[model samples]
Target chain A: MQTESKSPLELEQCLKCSICTAVCPVMNNTDAYPGPKQCGPDAERYRMKDIRFFDESALKKCLNCKRCEVACPHGVKVAELIQTARRDMSQHGPGLREIMLANTDIMGSLATLVAPIANFATGLQLSKEVLHATVGIDHRRTFPKYAGTKFETWYHRHAAQNQGQFKHQVAYFHGCYVNFNYPKLGQDLVHVMNAFGYGVQLLEKEKCCGVALMANNMYNQAKKQGQVNIDSMRKALQGGVETIVTTSSSCTLNMREDYPTMLGIDQKDVKEHLGLAVRFISRLLDEGNVKLVWKEGFKKHVCYHTACHMARLGWNVYTLNILRQIPGLELDILEQNCCGISGTYGFKKENYELSQKIGSTLFNDIEATNAEAVVTECETCKWQIEMSTSLPVINPISLLAEALDLEATQKANIR
Target chain B: MKYNTVIIGGGLTGLVSGIQLQEQGQRVCIISFGQTLLHFSSGSFSGEESNTDVQALLKNAGIATVAGGYRLTPLGELRPAALTLEGYYHSETAELKEKSFAIVRLPKYLGLPIEFLQDTLTAQGREVSIITPDEVVGCPAEVILVPACKAGYDLKKTYGKRVSLIAALPPSIPGQHIHAKLQQYFQKIGGTYINGDKVVRSTLQTDEKGVRVQSVETQNLGDELIVADHYILASGSFQSEGLQSNYDHVWEPVFGVDTNAPEDRTAWTALDFFEDQPYQHIGVLTDEAGHALVEGRPVSNLYPAGHILGALRTDIQNLNDALRIAKNL
Candidate 1:
């Protein structure tokens, strides 16, 4: 008998059953790239002897959506295996376009500084053509408009002082999307939390969760940012704030799961306290610690889309439970399909066509539902769905804030 | 989160139970880890033998099985199976009475045991000719047989001929279609199905109703409990990780349900390789009404359905037991 015990995700457990290949959205859309089975365990066995055993070119087409991992009955980390190989076999570093897309916090901060000019220039047709030619950002894509006032700026000025009166306090990690593109989601999260008698505080320092960085093969930069985020969580936990929540599904997945596995960041101390806002709040409601009272005569119809990352996190059930609790909300759940805009994957010129093709099934289904709006948890999904379809895609937290009876909830939850 | 019922597995039995419970207006949730073993089948379900609505239930999902009472195996042997994908080869008798047959060799495919099938058919005194897809138009044969994988399901309509398909090995396209349709139908009817998660722990309280499950915890839903009025353990047998084994013991991993495992390792198997083995049939213990047992006491609210209850191997038996249990709950 061997002395060592096997990890649950050992590569030897792969059954070579091709179920991973079936669930891969990338493989189904493109023949240029082999499926997860070929790129992952099938190649890893050969690559164990030498790194050059398999060609690394086809690995680039992977969307890193982690659906293969979700579909594997034996729990093999197919996406992680492919990603680790990319990290190891990569000979060339990220180019200017990748760096621009990967460093989300830096670009977000710069754009928000000159929000009006940045939004106008980014949306201009001539600028799109020039950037598509020079920078390789797809011309057909429109950038997420930067907020005029950042969430941090607004939070410090407006909501920081009044937080001290609440009975319980929790830290918020409003990620780059909330900090730069949409401050309203941050405002909504605060409204939902404050109504539950919980004080929401920002971390002393924060950085982009670096999901985009990792996908772009910028592991070192991702690790650097991941360390910064972990340190802020450590300080927050030291101050007795046990739970730190976020609005973005990708950020939560990056910190909770991908940090130690992909970037080699030790998030052991912080993972337990870190979660999505839906999970934390839904747990509170389940345990009878809080209740949500919606506004009178409120009625809305929305189709909830399961973002790829949200499905990987397995916390979509919590978000769905929260949506189902609304008295007048007519919720229709769309089948879980990858919207094909996996963060920066769909924004590149070469990937532009393939991404839309991969998402066509979802687009058709959403049209069939014809709900008034689309609801989802990931900001990137919101960006993809809203760009592809004519309907507005809003986050679940925003929906809660829209219908929540702030006065009644605040009075009821005064612990 | 709370529901009227929570199912441990999302395979055939668990899904049937969930559908039955939801049809009764009981809010239901099913926690499934990875894909089910339904992917290993060729859309072969066996509930037509029982007085159950399983045939109609599956028909509503657009997965109509052939009406014949037999199925053609990939190895050219005919077996009795109540259900097969609509276009598959199924007949009433074991023998293919057709005088001449053409088996189209699916190029670049190895899932079917073609050589073994040819050898078996030739020994049975049947005229079998292997032909390429290019020769299908000119080939003179009573009927044409084709492998299902790596080929379209609408072979009959596409070729405008007497085409019969057989399921190659898994990943079975026909079976996956069945699962996807049923799962979609389940969700469309308001049943909540949480994918890629498993229940890891359960809290049991002994009240007037002899030990009841108060709540359960899942691997992914950390620190939160899934509270339900009733729970079903349909996590499949050993191959599916419902029951796990170590050096000397076999036990049910979820909820610590009592299992019918031999204590000593020596008693796990028979002398011959093909002989019956104790390990293959090992599973959790449940009372007649399908209430799961712990330490010989039945948990009043916890029911064990499907193959996890042991002594169940056929699709009809699983559906009948799952439906009967769901109705009692």
Candidate 2:
């Protein structure tokens, strides 16, 4: 069943308990924020009486991390309230920077078309300064580089021929990050699935998960993308695809949690299929349906940074459990800390400093662990952590791919 | 999906118990409906003062407790309470009776009436002075009673423990502070907390010995069954809906545990509104082992704690009882 819609009367449920402030990462880092208690249900009472009572800038400062929602004893939907307020306040439409960042699929496609020039241009100081001045993207941050070939294109050339031959079938919803920026992760996902005797194919025509769009207050665009993704996923499911899996935790959470709850895609079949879209590694391990053949002498020290949405989705344990299976691989989990690059929120020049400040704890923890490399489930977290630290951050699936004996899979692929 | 223990509420008792169980290396998960009643707490724990064991447990959880001999209530009358996160006005001993106090009132601050406080303090044979400060900083009074505002301003930092915050009308600051600390402590020790979901129904297994809870189902998370070896029902009293009363009778809603209450509906409340009400003590009666009983038979795996234990004066007894039952577990 879907979660009941929170009514205006639910605002009265706030006991004025300032408990939300204590656990709020944003409040802990900066004094500029009035904390979720004040900005959410507290201000909501006033806003209900008069829409003029809204504080547009203060509301934007929220990371929408849902830490406040978790800390709230009364189920205040503090993050949802802040997001709704941002949506209502931006009724006139979002700024140019927001509009640009929200459309990841378009930018990703164009960037991949001119991969070398785009990657080189993003690295140059002069280009960064010019882009910052024009588009409000922070100059100091390093943009994720686009692959020479997108995942969909690579899949057609390499992996698509082997589809439908395996005993198990899983439709991969490779969100824009894995599709354009890190196609290797998508390839790794396919290789790992194929090694387990499961055939992997891309969803018929998936769109961006729309997490950035929803965060940027582009509700209509997010809804459209959600509908398209759902339809594509439904088509794949109808064609005997057993499960829908994703490499990114944020994208998985968007389909599993935000779609029905926030985006109003509550059709019975859609909800059932959405339930099938489990975290890739967790589902495989939990069902006990696949056997992982760990390569002998494969060992490394891996520190995991649990992405906020992954933790909220309750898949961090799954990631940890699967990673720990590697023999002699010493795993250290960083404290539950937000990476602070929440979709497009951290990309803005105004939020660059706050984003870094919020992520500093995670960075320091990673450095302290002295792990050979860092692993996380969310691509946004991967980019943020890698940019902030010297260690290379990779997905768990990529790490899993490395541990597999690729000779066996390559032989199977040749057959 | 499976844990060593599944605690029903996320209030002070449920959280504390969860932490204790997790420390014992049990996989614990706390399922909560929404806002805990602790939001109405005055941040004070008042009970049999000699029970240092419970106080030690609280201290172990990183919550510093002060003697808090007597503190002025919102009604202006002084009452005995054992407070946590003590402000300046909350004295550990009765020496506060001899001290000169100034009640500072801020403009447009309607939390506490200065005249009521003055009258109550004067009635207690203490001299009281009232001042309306333009700002809380640089006040001349040795001890100032200010509004209970914790955000945007830190009275303790500004006035250095000399300023004691009074409980505001509703969302109490001290209560919120303690609740946050408890939650953080519980999580730090590897306890899982699931908020914003209510346990709609529980699957029960009956055997020759007795009945035991097999798994619990929640409202929002569809089709996911939360299975635990042991279940702790700390859902609290009427405030959080642990115990429900209709025109005919009172009963625990979640498990339908038999409640200890007067059979007559007329005996539920007292004649005076300020006096102790009988219904306040009506809750799930438990066995000597703290296992909740249904129709005079104990559910071997179900243990009841906190306000749901049918104790009188819940604020005083909930924590102590919770600690006692949780330690034995």
Candidate 3:
């Protein structure tokens, strides 16, 4: 925990303005969580004597919402404050749930053993509720079930299909969620890459990007995790992978922006990765790199929900611009503030209702659009949208690669 | 109302005038709508004389030591007055200390936070410190930062960008539009201001002790009594109160505010014309005791201040002159 050194004069300037709260979708839904201003500087004012406190459930409730930062008049850094508070609580003996959540590297490696058992465990009606209760998670949400086969297993088996695509190749970073829960998205990404005439190599020997750990305020752990990820990316770059492509928006944002400040990685290399590696499935197709076989008679209306992490990294417009190129697809740009799932946020039982409330705006927007499908770059957003709406929510590349008539993509979708 | 004195206009001059009177153990009631100072203030003080020869003219008009800038030595007595001043020139070291700790104005549209900005600057090896005054009424930064003055709105969030909040008094979009609304609201909240009430004549009520300003006739308000133990004349510059020469004699409305002004506005105008002309000498005559001169006798309470009555140009520099006038009062 950081030493309490900020003065009362420093704390008094907050003015109790709820502008920060107004923008936080997490606070909009959850009653237990005071918005950023309240939990942050507002709460900082009323505490007796010092800033140190024991329990920090209120501080950890921030869904990593960047909206409050945008709405603040005084430019109060609410996100950093919340993260610091969480770090303080974690140091004061963070419970087993937090430790388990923060150590994704351990979880990622254990996926092979836990995959089937996890599915069976999650199948029990009371399992998720019990897990939420133990972890301080709100009781009304569901997590994505683990995939039958992990993404790495699939990537290694089909390594020889791209005999001689483009000389230029990209290093693929399949994040934990895409690797465990939605492995097919990674497989679809390969097909999309091949059609675009690029040599795509999966950096299967990668660790958790640790962005989630950082969000949960496990800074030192996040730094260590970031170093491992950075080393893997650095090696891939040395092996002639010009750009690092990843399906996860959170992973892309971390590698592109956060890693440089947090880990002192080669800033130029990171920027190059940002300029090129940071791309969505629909974006690759729009860039004319991926060959899309548009379904002969399929004409559909779809809305794209820009993810908050992706939006903060400034990749939102690029995704939207790419979507504009599809011939028969009518796109509704859903100005979603946040999906409110934010990885683990929606799955927590305590936050589930708040997540639903925060997500209601997006849910209503998707419903109002009356689109046949909802397309987004993030798998968590896809899951959150799927939970609320009856419309099919799929990865943007899955749609684009299907349009390209990739035989494997067609085969996978039919199943 | 146990008011020993009622000071009108809540701008810098008025506030300082009241502060000085309060320090002197007098009960001072300041009537202000609070939109007197222009929001954009640099807060520098230079004490140089304007070319207008107003001090010399006032001297010729039989008034010897009109209050001006002083370089206070260790002895504490004000030294010989400097003619022209700029920004907020302070004669004492105490005032200089405040200026060094002044916060730079942070403009809007810079999408960086104050801490981040500070970190970035510190990384670049620049020494930047911020200071806040005691009373803050609105949008305080993550740090409880206050403006240099009451009307100082532009906050320093970045190296160079101005930021201010739009109060919802009149409800408009929150930029310059809201600022305009607040300014109008300030005018309304301040004491009675009959719009377009132009003062044209001055009358003196002389007694054994001193000459008192009896009343003045405005074009609209007619004869309004400005009765008080003290009077502050801060009607602003020529653009605000019109100090133009009709034939040859240079004069101002009500009490001949700046009696020693240039016969022709061209004489006081700048060579660049566009550049700020140094015309601090264009002001009313005053006796050596820092009292206003009515025909040759000192008016006990009538005080000339700000851009209107000046030994220095307030625009280019004379902030210290304004401060001194307020402090001495």
* Number of the top DockQ candidate: 1
Error of 3 at B46 (Å): 40
Which wins on DockQ, candidate 1 or candidate 2?
Answer: 1
The complex in candidate 3 yields a DockQ of: 0.01
What are the per-residue Cα lDDT tens digits for candidate 1 across B1-329?
88999999998899988888888789999999888878888656754463337777777767776544777678877777766777776776767777677787876668888778777777778788888777778778877878876463545557754677777888777777777787888877789899988787889998775898999888788877789999988988876678877786788887788998888788978889888876777888888866889989998888887778664478878887788888887
- lDDT against the true structure, per candidate, is 0.85, 0.76, 0.54
On TM-score, the leading prediction is 1
Q: Give the runs in model 1 whose Cα sits over 4 Å from its true position.
A: A240-242, A411-415, B46-51, B60-62, B66-68, B95-151, B154-165, B206-210, B264-278, B310-312
Question: Model 3 over residues A266-382: C-alpha lDDT tens digits?
Answer: 555545553323254434544454444555665678887767766554454345545555567787766545877887666656667777888888888889888989888776788
Output per-candidate TM-scores for chain A, rounded to 2 decimals.
0.98, 0.93, 0.82
Model 2 steric clash total: 2
Model 1: per-residue Cα lDDT at residue A241:
82
Model 1, span A263-341: residue lDDT tens: 8889898898999999988888778989677899999999989888888889988888888889899988887789988
Order of candidates by DockQ, top first? 1, 2, 3
List runs of model 3 lying over 4 Å from the truth. Answer: A1-19, A30-34, A38-50, A53-57, A70-77, A88-90, A108-116, A133-139, A160-165, A260-268, A274-293, A406-415, B1-329
Worst 10 residues of 3 chain B by lDDT: B166-175
Specify the CAPRI tier of model 3.
incorrect
Writing each residue's lDDT as its tens digit, candidate 2 over A1-415 gives 5234457525765766666675577877787898898899989889888989898878888988776665565556787788777776655677888888889999998999999999999999998898799989999888999998999999999999987678678888889998889999889888887877778978777899899989888888888889898988888888888777777877777777777767777545855445312345555566676666667788889887777777566555456557656777787767667888988888999889999999998899899988999988788888898899989998888898888676564445434
Residue-level lDDT tens digits of model 2 in B1-329: 67889999988889878887888888888887665767777656655353576566567777777753766676566667755455635665554545566777776567677788888777776777877554445556556777665531365566657667666665566666666677667755667666656788888888997888889977545566778888999998876778877678888888888888889999999999999888887878778887888888888889888888764554557777666667777
